[model samples]
Target: MPPHHVAWWRPLFLIALMPIGVLGNLEGDALNAFRQSLIDSNNVLESWDPTLVNPCTWYHVTCNVQNSVVRVDLGKAGLSGTLVPQLGLLSNLQYLELYSNDLSGVIPVELGNLTALASLDLYQNNLNGTIPDSLGQLSNLRFLRLNDNSFTGNIPVSLSTITGLQELYLSRNNFTGQAPDFYNLSKLENL
Candidate 1:
């Protein structure tokens, strides 16, 4: 057999570990998940570099004591691009505030992975498309804001699935119709 034959298992093992590697570690998963989204959201702010030492301490990045990224607030910093699907990987993300920018494209359905999200703010931007129904998956969401955009569609009934939702804002958009009534939603302190 060729020298690569025995090493085949190594690649296979690495491949098999990819998903586990992504999900097992929260910080790794979050970085992988938002990798593309962050890239699209701006012109700078690349992934980890020795020059930066730690990415969480960057201007807009916020992290917990464990050095795990938690929030990314980049509002009106001249960011421009479409929403990428990789953002859904941030399982621990609580807030994603990016307003008054020039972002466009569909809000990826992958964001539903952020079940721990508490707030999601994307307004006064150039975004357009359907609000992902997967948002209802965020059981810990307290606020969801998407206004002053060019989206065209009805509110996803999945939104009502969020039992812990306290505030839901979808004003000043292309949404047409009444809100749907989802089921099994508890802790509905506010609408």
Candidate 2:
């Protein structure tokens, strides 16, 4: 090929590889957003170096074989802070375990974007405010533990749409009004 053709192909080649190179960084950016929003006194997140291209290499983050974040095991990590909206960017995330922490603030409505989520364990936190109705969007969710928080307001009626929900825990919250009729959650074994 001519020199001019070679130069043209080089740019195309780089562009083709761009998604692969940038995919990891996008997820890393999402996690970094969470890191920045939190106050980590014990430095359990010390390995979460934003400079790294892949957050999968960071502690407490679990990724799938494709290098997509699937689970975050940061429960009881002695951290506190509001959850960031960017967490919804982890499109493939299935399990979000941030329970037993000092975290406060409303659960981000953006979490509704995690359609792949199956387990969301935020129990035993200081988080307050009405649980976002957006959580009803998690159709794949099975185990949702938002118990022991300061959440107020009526539990979202949309939650009744999750037919696959097996375990739902909302005890210890300050919810008022009649709870949603969960007759649609036929798979529910615990509530």
Candidate 3:
């Protein structure tokens, strides 16, 4: 091929790849933001290098064939800190396992933006505050565990609306108000 043809094809190819690159960057940035908010005493997050284009290469992170983030499995990694709102940017995320960590602060309402989420296990953390109503927006969520946290306030009635929810664990929290009936949750087996 002629040099001019090469030049023409180069730009077009890069443009074609731009969307994938951009998606990786977005997911990487979001996970990096979460890393920044934490104190990783166990060096569990040492692989979270921000210089990477995507978080797929990072430890405890999982991605799909499209290079989009799908799961963040950091359970019991001895991490302590607040959850970043940027995590909501993982649009394809299905599972978020941060259980058994010392993570504190309110659950970011932005997490509600994870519409594709199926299992969200934040159990055994130091997280406090009302469960965000935005979580109700996770219509696909099945297993929702917020147990052993310091969260307070009524169980968001909105959560009752998650028709597919199969496991709801809110035990050992300081939550107030009468327990919301789970009878409407046809798939719910544990509460």
What lDDT score belongs to each candidate, Candidate 1 first?
0.71, 0.94, 0.94
Clashing pairs in 1: 33-86
Select the stronger candidate by lDDT from 1 and 3. 3
Q: Write the per-residue lDDT of candidate 3 for residues 1-191, one digit (tens) a residue.
A: 77876676788888998986898999899998899999998899999999988889988888999989999999989999999999999999999999999999999999999999999999999999999999999999999999999999998989999999999999999988998778999999998
Best by TM-score: 2
TM-score, prediction 1: 0.71
In terms of lDDT, the best-performing candidate is 2
Summarize candidate 2's per-residue lDDT along 8-112 as a digit string, tens digits: 778888899899968789999999999999999999999999998789899999999999999999999999998999999999999999999999999999999
- 1 or 2, which is superior by lDDT? 2
Candidate 2 wrongly placed segments (more than 4 Å): 1-9
Off by over 4 Å in 1: 1-54, 181-191
Instruction: Determine the backbone clash count of candidate 3.
Output: 0
- Each candidate's TM vs. the true structure? 0.71, 0.93, 0.91
Models sorted by TM-score, best on top: 2, 3, 1
Off by over 4 Å in 3: 1-17
Candidate 1: tens digits of C-alpha lDDT, residues 1-191: 89967887998888887864343354554444454454444455554332343456456677776565688787776767666665776666788888888888888899888887898888888788888888878878888778789888788888887777776667788878886874455655544
